[model samples]
Target chain A: MKADIIVDTKGLACPMPIVKARKAITAMKTGQVMEVLSTDKGSLNDFRAWVSQTKNELIAHEEQNGEYRFWVRKL
Target chain B: MDEKSQKTTIVLFSGDYDKAMAAFIIANGAAAYEHEVTMFFTFWGLNTLRKEAAVRTKKGFLERIFGAMMPRGAEKLGLSKLNMAGMGPQMIKHVIRKHKALPLPQLIELAREQGVKLVACTMTMDLLGLQQEELLDGLEYGGVAAYLGDASDGKVNLFI
Candidate 1:
């Protein structure tokens, strides 16, 4: 069974949100998914780029109620 | 590692002198890893790349005041909170200079030699009335869209 970890990095600035998200997902086993919520517009790009560096998967990204929702699957 | 991955883009938006130098350090590190690197300089980041200024540190009050009056790039500023170990500023300057690190212009040239792309923000250039000649040569002018597009396919997108 895959786990789903949710990270709320709503108010953090550049590097912090993605840094935290990367730290969180690394503990998970392969195929587990992590969800991240952020308010910084730059975080979207930052997170996506970060995911590319690691062997993780960015499964989905959606914006709702002024918050960004990102889902990443551990690789 | 696959041979097909494209390089990353780093956008630095700082007016501080030290931080800009750190940004260049980071870019050089990334380039050493065989990653394609692109750096976009905007706002205070532009001052470091200016052609005519050679800002040096001064010790005395008069020289300090004169140094203040002179144009120092981002590398000359105080260290960040993450680097404040009391000797952080001194250590940073020592390491940077000891590395025979090129000045911003020479560093940009070295980056070009290593295949790193240098870009300046067109919007900020217009706002500051900076001409192409005022900037180091071989610079591309663009906006946020340009950076985004370059970073869209990148594995590393850093904002320093």
Candidate 2:
């Protein structure tokens, strides 16, 4: 899963990770993929909710060693 | 996106820094979700829009005292609890910075960047004797009707 841009939100709290992700996604072109690395536990649900609300596609998401990675494609 | 169907309105009535942060965070978050968002600042919440420098204005004795007691601007706001003469806000700011989290001002800026409407309650401004020049620029001024108009069809309405 390759991405056009990778945003590392590690160690950031709720809203910050989502805020940073939104900013990153906004800069990318449509159909481009963004990889977000966040350590916030709540991001699992936050990203899902964000994608649902914004109509963006969450192509892939996984958690490992307490880190959450999400691959989102801009709509 | 159906902008008309997805609307969020926040009535920020608290002057506390922590509460203000929460309001901005929620507002920014909703805006990120492609929702039309509006924030109405009234009473003490108007302090968040105040400028650091004092702007001279004619006011009654009560309004003068109100102005003197409240923090001049967002930068001077204290935490709602455990403020310890303002140490709490500083500590929280330090933590937010350490965590790479956006502070309230930055959050507000991001909200604006995301097209969130910032509205100042004109009635409260008059009551508190806050002049237009005393507040930060790029804000819409209106009374409760304006707020009610924005909040009426909003799917999410919050008072913080």
Model 1, range B38-121, lDDT digits (tens) per residue?
888877676566556543432556534543543444344445554574376667566656644444444555566656777899
Worst 10 residues of 2 chain A by lDDT: A12-21
Q: Scoring model 1 with DockQ, what do you get?
A: 0.02
Model 2: pairs clashing at backbone N, Cα or C within 3 Å: none
lDDT of 2 by residue, B1-160 (tens): 4645488999999999999999998998888777889999999899998988888887889878888888988878999999999899999999988987888888877888889999999988988888888898999999889999989889999999
State residue B150's C-alpha deviation in candidate 2, in Å.
1.2
Q: Residue B98 deviation, candidate 2, in Å?
A: 2.8
Docking class of 2: medium
- In terms of TM-score, the best-performing candidate is 2
What is the Å distance of residue B69 in model 2 from its true position?
1.5
